[model samples]
Target: MMKRITKLVMVIFLLTGISTVNGQDKYGTEPKKCQQNLSLFHESVKAKNFEGAYENWKWCFDNCPKASLYVYSDGIKIAENRYKTGDKTAAAKLINDIYTQRIKHFPKNLGKVYSDWAKSLIKIGATKDQVFEKLDTAFKADPTGMSIKNLANFFQEVTDRNKDTNVQKVFDTYDDVVEGVNNKIDKLTKQSDVINAKDSLGKTLTSKEVKKRKNIGINLTALGQVEGVLDRIISKVATCDRLIPLYQKNFEAHKTDSKWLRRAVSRLFSKECTEDALYPKMVEAWVTSDPSPKAYIFYAGILEKRGEKKKALEFRKKAIDLETDPYKKADYLYRIARTMYGSSAVSYARKALKHRPNMGKAYLLIARMYAKSANSCGTDEISKRMVYVAAVNKARRAKAVDPSITSKANGHIRSYSAQFPSKKILFVAGVKSGSRHKVGCWIGETVTVP
Candidate 1:
């Protein structure tokens, strides 16, 4: 009888423990009730029944504001439905409330939340300055969280508002957004390369991989469009004439600011404003401030201009020697390639690839060099066109290894393929299309005859 009583007690204890565990929740919501409400609202959302989900979702939201991130997410859907029904004021308020609660509960998502808030404000026809304030906050908090459209809009707004007084701000924001865009493209390209590698040697990709590739391609195209828009908007104020004076005026204030100096020098150099005295001054300031490889590269350019060939070469070599990061080293090498001629450019490009195999731009550069030297690379017409074949091969390899430059590689492929030796030429040379032919001269790359 006593043993039976002990077993009963143990069963009661187990049941009590289970009840206690089941009752507690992350946000201290009554588990049974919250679960019922959350499930009902989630199902309604899935069913597109915002009306059906509204009451339960609101109840869960008010009762357990910290229940889950989905509470706020679902709230947006509910609010949107409210707006569609002709209650814009209430909808806007509710949307704001949802964002506020989301930030309160999930502070780590602050950056993205602010960007979403800014976008929402923009959609509702907020004033340019108001929208700019939110966007600036978002960018300052985390530029990476912003979408390409938002970033472009942000820069446009800044330009519109402060075009006369603060051109530097416009320039700085442009640089930031461009870097962010390129970084995003690089990431997407690397992802594509991985997915592409999974396909068989002679077979098609799986359905899942195909879908993934399509999504990446769509995103890259969208980003490219946004970049075009950004350039157009910034071009109004970033003209060489405007840039030179504006930079000259502020040079003194920002001379010690290495980041600012580097950007200023790079911009001036890209605009071919190097003939201006300000360009050399900025470059010298940059070197004095940082003395990094980037600064040294600029200084080297000045030396070359002054006809100090030996000094320029030494400075260039010093920059390469000082750069420790493989990626940075590769970038320096690629820059050197740009300034070089003939086979020297190809050699430096090849060296850059050694340090960073994913530098697709380097491959494109090498291909261009080969195409330019087609007449010099071979003694005969067929042999000269074979250099185009070599260029096309390099371009194809670039696309295979880095999807970020796939469009560029495809362009090179098209241009070179059109210039390829006709079948008649191949026949006359007694070379088959698939047979390898050596491209003599400085470019020793073997290419398939076409």
Candidate 2:
């Protein structure tokens, strides 16, 4: 530094035209152009311009060495985009390079980009070990993320991808594809995580979390190893005893996030260990507190899943009444039809079709309702078989409107093709007549696990 100062002084004294890059920091602070390039990179991604993203990202990475961490996320996103959109080799190269060069920056964004990128990898069918490895790396890099445990827990189920019979039946409908490199991570496949998943919420652990734990117990019911999952959920809820009042007070806070709460409800329903005395109240809490269409629908769906047809129908109707989304309202109506499956269900399904004329699921429901008549599950003759043809026609129309549900819609059509119903039709309404009697009847007459 002294030598440079002396040189500068001598240059000025000698009146020489010695020059230097003014305003440039010797420590390599990024230039404004780098920021501009990064912005452009984001814009290109938003615009789906893959070519532009690579170019802009390249410029940003070259100019902003210190901010290379930021580029890693973008690079990963572009790589996924490339893979999903059909540039397999290029996508693989991009993922490999970004992962290699930015290993230290793995947890830089933590949740926003990092989690999403991991989800994308899962969508591509990443193996469980691979996803866990990445998440483990992320935790090692920045274990401070509020969702660290939550993400870990979420990925625990990746292996159960096959368990979603519904997703498997309608897999082709949703455009879920992540090509190129394999995603070995599978969620829902791992053992339950014991790590504390501190909620990312700014508020204290919410009544919502309590409710969430409450529901987790429910969702664990009937699944294999039900006792263990139920115990875990009960433990979580018990930990929040002091937070019960807060959970009660902040019930309204959940209007903004009812889906999460409903998920907890579903989880709770899955658990078989819930106190019998607490069951009705817990179900009521979900139904009344989560008044949103989705919450109501999910709650009703949970009841329907447990073969509580009357309650399911009621909740389904409530969802239909609360929902403002035309599509969603139709969806609820179809759910109602799925539960009731008579003229009443048919009426709602038609109403749903009327509201969202293009919805294929509604048409599928119409067919299912038609097939309900032929359902041998009923002690009396099933609803009626002739109506199924009309239902199939409606389902076909729905498929015409939205091609995605074509497979399921087609399934509905084929379901009628076979006159026999493969599944049971629990006299759901009969169960509501009285609890003890219904329990006895269900125990005596209902189907059991095969």
Candidate 3:
């Protein structure tokens, strides 16, 4: 009888401990009630019954905020539905609470959360400063996680606040935002290329792949839009007059800073302020401090500006050699080509194409070079005009390879095609429309007589 009583007491204690553990679970003091409400909330959401989901969602949110991420995600949907159905005040309050709770419970994607919160603030007619505060937090947390639209908004806020008093901040913000957007665009472009290739080959994509392709397109478009916005915002303050003075004042302080020197050199180069005395100083400092591929490229541009073509070519070659990324290598080659003319330019452009086969800009650059060389390449009307045909061919190839530049390539094609040899001239030259003709001089390309 004594052994039985002791064993029964031990069993009762264990049962009480189990109940305490269950009560203290993540689902709060009422674990069973929280779980039941969460299930009902999720089911109603799946059924698109926002009105029915609200009570259960509120219960889960109040009782078990840390239960699951879906608590916040589904809560957001419920709030949005409320907003759309004319419950703006209550919905906005709930959204604000949900964002706060989400950050408290799940802070991994804080950048996206902050950005979404900023957008919500905007929708609720919040002040620019308030919106900017959230956006600033988002960008600083994880710029890559922020939407392209939010990035644009963030930059605009920075510009509006600093454009006059702290222009350096504006430039810095512009660089950061543009770099982030470009990185995203580059990534999305690669994904888009793969999916497009598969689709072009008549391969059927899975539902997920199709959705991914659509999202890539949407993101690419948003990135492009943001780029335009950034350019427009910076153009006003990035002119040579403003940039020269700004860099001049800050050069002594930032001379040893490679990043500052690089930005100064890049901005000066872009604004055509290289003619100023400070440009070479920044370039020299950049190369000395960083000595990277981009630094070498900037130094090469300075050398070329000073008419030191041989030394410039060496530095450009050095830049190309230092770069390991195929895309960047191709870009360096293209940049070097842009500094040249005639056959040399075409040669470097072709080298770029070797590294990146779909580099349509290189082909377009070759087309422009060919068109400019038309008169120099041939003496006769027929031969001279045939150069335009070569240009047209390259432009068409550019359009075929890179959809991003189709409009620009089409414009080039239209202009070049107009300059083609007249039918009378072709007939007089005895060159049949379908017959192949070799272009003379540096081009050395075969073309159809048409």
Model 1 pairs whose backbones collide: none
Q: Is candidate 2 or candidate 3 better by lDDT?
A: 3
Highest lDDT against the true fold, candidate? 3
Task: State the lDDT at 353 in candidate 1.
Answer: 88
Quantify all predictions' global Cα lDDT against the true fold.
0.82, 0.50, 0.86
- lDDT (Cα, tens digit) per residue for candidate 2, span 1-450: 999999999879666432222223311355567767777888787787866688878766555644545577667777777788876766766675666566443435554344454555565676766665665554334322314333334323331342233322111111111100001011111111111134323436667656654443332221222223323433333223322333345445663454434543444444442334333444556667666776676666557657887887776667777788765676677766665645667677778777765555666665565555544423442223323434556667765544445556666767664542223432433322112211121112221211
TM value for model 3? 0.76
lDDT by residue (1-450, candidate 1, tens digit) is: 999999999999999988776557453557678878988998899898998899999988888777777798788888778877857887888887888788888786555678888877766666777777878888887766677678777777888878898888888887887777777776786677677556635557879889998888777766555556777897778778998989988888998999999888887877677888888888899999999997888898898899998998898889999999777788888998988888899899999988877688899999999999999988999889899988998898887666556767888999999999998888877878888889989899787776
* Number of clashes recorded per candidate: 0, 38, 0
List runs of model 3 lying over 4 Å from the truth. Answer: 1-49, 64-70, 84-87, 186-214, 358-360, 370-450
TM-score of 1: 0.81
- Each model's TM-score, in the order given? 0.81, 0.38, 0.76
**Candidate 3 residue lDDT tens string, 231-256:** 77688888998998888888888999
Q: Which lDDT value does model 3 have at 193?
A: 74
